[model samples]
Target: MKLKLISSIFILLGYNSFAQNAKTDLSDSLVKDKQVILAKYVPMANGEYLYKGYQIPIDSFINRVNDFRADFNAQIAKDKLSDLSILKEKDVMFYSYNVLAHYQIYYGMDSVGMENFGKVVQEKRGEPNFYKLIDSAQKKAFPKRLSNDERKRLDDIIRKSTDLNDAALFKTSAAYRTWLNDYLKGVQRKKYLADTALGYGGDNVAMLKVIAAEISDPFIKEYLLYTFTGTVIKSVKNAGAKESAYKDFMAGTTNETYKKGIMEIYINYKNMSSNAVSPDFNYTDINGKLVSLKSLRGKYVYIDVWATWCGPCKAEIPFLTKIENDYHDKNIHFVSLSVDRMADKAKWISYVNDNKLQGIQLMADKDFSSDFVKKYNINSIPRFILIDPTGKIVSGDAKRPSDPALRKQFDSLLK
Candidate 1:
């Protein structure tokens, strides 16, 4: 009796282990199958396989697409997940809907595509924005800026459209983020078209407030502030206006990341604002003597902030040389300040010597990190700046040597 009992216990334990292994095997198979389906069903020829002159009969194409969607949906049902712990299942559903929408639109089933898209926004777990996926299609459809009348027609169409709004979509859908980006761009473009000077610093501040008020969704609003703030700040030519816009946008958002970014930019703009005292620099000249901006006082200073590795900077060399020669006897001092790495100091010296570079050739002690460069927030090379006689900034972001505007400005200033 004891032997029989032991044998039965072992058999039961073995059976339970076998059942667990089988369940695991089935789960693994489901995940692999989901990946395969997502990979296999993407429409070809810009998702216009049915309509872009593929020569397929309309009815036949519709049947084939419907069958694929059914199979895809059936797989999604089998791979239904109870929680967000594993994203594979969620991805399966997302891609399934994505594929369905792609075909529906291309097969001239706009109403059906719109219906499925409606389901995507209301669905709780994953990202599902058809507009985000069909970016190329949208671009192809609207390749250039529309006239006011054309814009109104499209705007009316867009306004008439309706769907559920989900804030959580931003968390999961890269597509949702993309769609928001495009939408924000459209808003900015419309503002620009309405008044070409809308984003020039303080002008866009009210626009930002209006947008924030209009967009009740926090996630979407946060993203808009982040993107739109950067654009406003960069386009602001006036320091006072830039500061005001920065402070307003900063006050409006509690997002640490956005604030941090804007603060850095604000500091840069603040330091380089017109009429602000210019940042002082003491760098070694080509002849190895320290040349300070203070020493070259009582005259206008035109500083070309450049580097040896920059192609555009090199391209402007001839123009700069010509300007230097033309203004050789003028009150303005043309100073070419190179922000080359200290380790490449010899390379910079060699390039300047070989090229017979003109102007007061000087190099920073530390490439971009030098106090003056950092103060001016010089990131891209080939930047130009003009300082007044009293060590005040005339144009912290001046025109390039190649631009006729630069010469015109110089003529006006010198006169």
Candidate 2:
């Protein structure tokens, strides 16, 4: 938390050097000649604002972004910066708010377990009226030198861009959703909030609606809506509900890339969850003996889908080994499937031998794109899966060994 706050402060201060050494043009920086004009709606957080309320790290990020933009414009005036720099600055005007909205929802979610965030939501979780706040903030930050027409124009383009493109905005809005993955699966299983259903995006969407309404830019508005729409489509575990949400999002969206990507997430999960038949792999173990997922059908299988070179995968090994030791004599079978390249076979074996690795150490016939990996739509690792005695998937995307919940999952199955 302290690191985030300090980093945000630096983000505001670093631009000072950038503004003082402003260049004549940014044509070389950008390949295109055309400028993407946008509404510049910067949020402010005075010392009092922090002291009184909204003192969370997420709030600090938002405040820092607010201060950064203010300092940015001041520096532009100080150096009489170029149109290109000003355009670059303005194009990212809505970025901070977008980030703020993103993290605020993440922190507010029940699973994240941030108490201050929970308090913030409890105290102010009703209808959002961010426009009034923005209006008030802008009035205080206004310049006295500008003429009436100039002020009107500033208000128009800087706070309410006329050329807002929803499709274009969605292309770049992905960064905001990066922090969303961990909590999503938790939310889906009703493991977090009591009131929220499997696919509930209402908590985030309600706040987003207020933000979307407040944002004078059309693209920013649509972009927030997309967050709500895309989040629901991504969060739900029920196939039928997910399909419906996908169709709804696609029907309303115009961005083909965004549409295709969102649809693909849904498509990949289809027929790949609980009760689905586990994909079989005909591969050799580290001992040069052939083994397949089908051969271990009588006992429960705890499969770790990993690669030798993956740092995150290695990090989970200790905890994984502990689980194996704890349940050593049980009817459950533990296996580690390496999605390493065929060329790395020697290295994989060497590592297994060096570590004295427990469980079945098997390697994919090919690398990550092997048919078995592709069948489950595996992307990131180290992914874990649990399979029943009958070769049906218990959880295609099971909890990680590092997660405390993984033990509970194991107990629920074994006991």
TM-score, per-candidate, Cα-based: 0.47, 0.45
lDDT of 1: 0.59
Among these predicted structures, which one has the highest lDDT? 1
lDDT of 2 at 385: 83
lDDT (Cα, tens digit) per residue for candidate 1, span 1-415: 2232222222322211111000011122223443344334333443333223222333444454446556655655664464432343433334344343333223232333433333332232123554363333333332332345643543443333222244554455543344444444446545533333543344355456646655778866766666556656655555555566677778888988778877876776766664788889999999899999999899999999888766456657878989999999999899999987889989999999998998899999977767887677565567889998889999877998878899999999887
List per-prediction Cα lDDT, in the order shown: 0.59, 0.54
Worst 10 residues of 1 by lDDT: 16-25
